[model samples]
Target: MVEQSTRATDRPLPLPRANLLHLLEQMVLIRRFEEKTMEMLALNRIRGYCHWNIGEEASVVGAVTALTENDRLITSYRDHGFAIARGTPPETVMAELFGKEGGCAGGRGGSMHMVDIARGYFGGYGIVAGHLPLAAGLALAADYLGEDRAVLCAFGDGATNIGAFHESLNLSKLWHLPVVWLITNNQYGMGTSVHRASAEAELYKRACAYEMYSEQVDGMDVLSVYEATERLLRRAREDREPSLLETLTYRYPGHSYADAGKSYRTKEEIERWHQRDPIRLFQRYLEEHGILNQGEYDLVERRVSQKIEEAVKFAEESPFPSPDTLFKYLYAEEGTK
Candidate 1:
């Protein structure tokens, strides 16, 4: 019975010193990573469709931090943030983006398909809401096997319109599977605003049709996201109750690398969201609380910048997959032919 709120809270959660710092660091790191990624995409160093998570740091970092080591994480194509937040090395992520063999997916999956199985992060799905069924399947497996594990499935607002969203929710509720369905409602799904697409713009209400518990929180506030996620996950793990959480956030960039995100969005709209930037909001909370000072914040920024540079360097130096090994990993059993 998590208390429900759809707005950002000014009060900071009573987190430990280390946890607070980790949250700040992760948000800053993600912002820097996306900024660097944007630069690389512009310079043509990284190829293929790239979606920047410039404004959704709190949604990613807060949710990921709530999960245990054994929990599974799955998400939509806006995945780099989730991957980095889940502890996949920046170097490997950049390499994957660069299509180098050093990538987490062996450079085969590229940006939309980043996978790190060892870290319990299932690959990102490219199709809209296509991964929802897979997430339900994973939850069913854990339920059937009597495993003490839960799954967190993340997707965008537009995904709700897809039939699979309803199907997954119905099944998860009926079966009492351990899963937390997180909707990162960044206001828009691609170029269209959520209002223009979803009939029930308050997405959390959709869970009511399936008799599942649902709540919405301010995605720009990392503390609120963290608290709600932690409670929901606890219920999922302990009581085997599936739930839906909608985080009200926004993405600064357009849908992908190709779209400039300006055709459908106004300059004023983008600037307004920037004023409530997740990283800046969290930083204000931390500084005002006497947890992080200007000097320490600068140190964090410098450290993250260096890490991003190293990641870029690693991507630059890593080799692309050799053509000779192209046929490898095509099947579960090799040498069949």
Candidate 2:
């Protein structure tokens, strides 16, 4: 078994030598996990909508790795890796996508709405930009309650243009809420490219409109993302400020699993991103640095692959939620009078 690096100090720092290895492991796990989801989708085992995290693994893993379990996470539809990195088990997440009773959301939320509140992952929202205010509100509540926890609210570039993005970011900044608006700018908002949709393509500047601190980083390099996010997240936690981090990345796969990475983006475009695949890049760095031998890296790959297989098996064997149990935990229960 791979040695679990749960100790925060023992875990890799944001460096090419150390943090890069953890980032690579996360990227590989996400890749394998998404591949399994696609296989399940093809077999009709996973119903409803699904988005591949194939290309955006670096953003989710890098941001979440900098956060503690107490920090809140809410994101848009493309959310599997975010959930996994935020502490939702692979089995529960897969089962949720599979619509089984064992799922984190009790099989109700389906592919675009996986939630594990215990892990502080509030939800994966299906409606675009639906969770922006929810995250901002979470930060507001945390502030009101004098809690030390911060919130990491993630979304795609497309949602960044929507009303909620503007409204929520403004609110968080105005009130100095403990929130980090982490936007994964993967060039396209579904089928629409960022250059076409966004009036000002440099989204981090949007934070300046709210007079919030902002940053831009190469999303493909997980080390760079972690370095930036760690600084911003710590600032947010310490000062209860709103920060915006725009990661310039690309999605090798299509907007959703239904679309097979074609149409707008050509084969050459996708192939280019494959050449810089974050997992492969860090794996190379790991081998060169001796932090991970080629043999050890292979072992990590095989172990995560096995974990994915077991998660699939668990999802396949899990039963669907019963009709009688529907709506059991949809909302918070009323307090006794």
- Which number leads on TM-score? 1
Q: Please list the residue runs of candidate 2 whose C-alpha ends up more than 4 Å from where it truly belongs after superposition.
A: 1-20, 330-337
After superposition, candidate 1 runs with Cα above 4 Å error: 1-12, 334-337
Q: List the residue pairs that clash in candidate 2.
A: none
Local distance difference test, each candidate: 0.91, 0.83
Model 1 Cα lDDT, one tens digit per residue, 1-337: 1224533334545689789899989999999999899899988889999987889999999999999999999999999999999999999999999999999999999999988889999989999999999999999898899888899999999999999999999999999999999999988888899889989988999999999999988898898899899899889989999999998899988889889889998999889889989999888888887888999999999999999999999999999999998987888775464
- Model 1 scores a C-alpha lDDT of 0.91
Q: Please, what is the TM-score per model? A: 0.96, 0.92
Worst 10 residues of 2 by lDDT: 1-10
lDDT of 2 by residue, 1-337 (tens): 0022121233354365555666677788888999988888889998878887777887788888888768888998888999888878899999998899999888888888888888898999988888999998999999999888999988888988789889999999889999999999888988888889988988888888888999888677676677778888788889888899988778877888777658788788778778867677666656555678878888879989998988999988999888987777767679733
Query: For candidate 2, what is the TM-score?
Result: 0.92
Lowest summed-lDDT stretch of 10 residues in model 1?
Answer: 1-10
